[model samples]
Target: MPETTAASSRTGRLLAAPLALILSVGSLTACGPTDDGPHADGTRPSSVTSPSVTSPSASGPSAPGAPSVPAAGKTAGTGPTTRHTASSSPAAGRDPDDPDDRLHQWMESGSIPMNASYHWPMLDTSARLADGEKFLFEEHCGARRTPETDSLARAAWMEKARPGKNDGDQNWLAQETIAAHLQDGKRKASALFGGLAKELQACGSAHTSVTYTTRDSRHVAATIVLDKDTARPTTLHEYLAVVGDNVLELSLWATPYHQDGGNKPDVAWPGPPDTSVFQAMTTPVCPQGKQC
Candidate 1:
């Protein structure tokens, strides 16, 4: 089985456009360890390009409509991009049920574990940038629509795991640039997550969009789909993975928000998508963050 993913990105008021599609997050490649390695200040780079597990798509990072925040009027990045007491990750062999095994539980814990079969897992190594498959949605910062408020210091991590036997019961996908940051970053993350979560459930029978910021201060854009009607209603869950300084995000889709009731419309949208590399909306997962 393959991992469920929803690709996305943010620029200003609009989210990176790649988010509009299930930009398949094929097997991911690293931007070289150093490209995503920790900095003296404990901060990661603004944008990173991970390798692809599958072949590159005709439409990739250069996909038109990807959002970005420009300089000038863009809001400032919040929190401590300059300092932090970097902590070690729990050993992969650590006990899963052991509460102590969740040192970076704040990162994602099991919010979006890979399904049973697929053993392929890709890790994200940035507090503020896209990781793994999210490499394609990268956007620069600018004078676009960034969160106006300042932010607090934050932390983040990423992974692309494959799950086998998606029994539809736990058959959901997600894509996130979730993180734990300063009050300001928290607010921004909250706004983007909350905004998308609310709308994912309300688009009765329509599609939606995604938006966020870049490390360079740019606004971005993405997209969302509407109401699902199937034996297993498409359920989408969007939230912040915050636990103290370790705040992160989870864009999981387990059930439908606005499941169709009355009758199957003439054109009942197909229930979600397949187990392709990248997933989207009810059918897929949110890309990076709002951006992803």
Candidate 2:
């Protein structure tokens, strides 16, 4: 196993929070063509990576060691809603499907309600957030491997982890890679959100809102509304607590909508990062004006 540096660890914490948001909804949804939305060319994107399990190698635990499960019955309410920020808007030409459009006719007809709720153990805790970020990087960005297999691994992981099982070493690789990227300033807000918009567009709409709550509890929100449908799905919601210089406790949430009109289905649990069908997170060696 490769050693992760302290700076890399800090980056993992920050990136983990927001990156967790990106996978939350997608991981929770059921596996299927509808779940794996088509790409811009109307093709299903690849999945995230998974650890090789030829044998149960001696490692720490099946899941990353972190926050203990919340008290058996205690539940956290949906946090307060903050105003939207400007940078959160979707990109140009990225529009949402109209509520009245035939494409979204199922939702527009009201048979699905167009609204749903999803809840988990609140994996946003500092430790889990760090782990989640690591998973995203190793799985999507291919920090230690080539991108070709990384893409396939990501898609496969998403499909398999739909059940929420903790992934082994592969998950750790992803978490570490993401931490390194964020610490290097290669994964800033703009780049992070932009990539998220592109990913969400595959589901149904690309519009998104991002909210960050400071340690002091002050909340900041940013939104990007796709030009097509005008729907504002929340791609990242998190809390940033001061850690050290250039670092903070990052908590994240990613929610994509399959608008089913006024009667939307319950938001599915995207299981775990292990089964996500998306590219790994990586620092583009030479990005073009921040649009990696």
Candidate 3:
């Protein structure tokens, strides 16, 4: 069967299972606040563009009409730009726009397998970026050696050999699955973007916008913005990727004062980093006490 068709079928079965029941209960109760921080009423502001997914067949890195990179020396604060916000909906309710709903449904239906890769995009990003500039340096510099990259590559290979991870499971299957998918040739950038959109929507603020593009005809660019001050208290940005219908990957970034009220003494520097391909990917993983 075609992958989409099979995914649809699996979704149907998942919606009918115990996991679905649990998610339904949790979504209704444990999610987040419901007040629209900046853009309420389910309507995104005019300043922002709706989520977009560009398929591999449509265009590669040099595709015309793709979102352009910010000009050199331009800062994020030079003018108005779209921002991201967390979901404000009650936790127990189903996110009407959740892209992972299908995956969650499948997991609930008991389709989850043991020792499968799970891709957790949001957590992965957050964990990598929690330390700010240090984290950023590692992601872009490859200054440190870690098992995550190799582990993720191995997980990707294993996915074809067995059932993949399920959504809502506490295990790190989602991240592993995404790692595996990124290494897979068949996976497209659009699928990754689509999965990111779903995960962002589930957070509920409706002010977040995520965009991906090719930076300088080489690197894949991922950007997120938080529009509201209220939502900014929790997180400023997150990066995500989709491995498959059931797998997603993610990372987080924030301004220094995003969580605490303590403001930076100097003007905030914004825009993408200045680095090479090898540096950009590993800059956020530098070990503590090491200079990136």
TM-scores of the models, in the order given: 0.26, 0.20, 0.24
Give candidate 3's total backbone clashes: 50
Q: Best lDDT goes to which candidate?
A: 3
Report, for all candidates in order, the number of backbone clashes. Answer: 92, 54, 50
Clashes of 2: 54
Each model's lDDT comes to: 0.32, 0.27, 0.33
Q: Tell me the spans in candidate 2 whose CA falls farther than 4 Å from its real position.
A: 1-234, 249-251, 254-258, 261-292
- Arrange candidates, best lDDT first: 3, 1, 2
Model 2 poorest ten-residue lDDT run = 104-113
| Worst window of 10 by summed lDDT in candidate 1 | 135-144
Q: How do the candidates rank by TM-score, highest first?
A: 1, 3, 2
Q: Is candidate 1 or candidate 2 better by lDDT?
A: 1
Please identify model 3 stretches exceeding 4 Å from their true place. Answer: 1-178, 181-194, 197-222, 231-250, 255-270, 273-279, 282-292
Q: Please write out the lDDT profile of model 1 over residues 1-292, one tens digit for every residue.
A: 1232222222321554455433443223233236668766888877766553222323334435644333444454432441222333212133335443333322232323342322312222222232212211121101122233111111133332222333533344444543333333445555544433333233334333233211111122223322333443433333332323232333444433333543322222333222221222111233344432
lDDT of 3 by residue, 69-137 (tens): 544566544452222133221122223344432121111212122122333223222221110121221
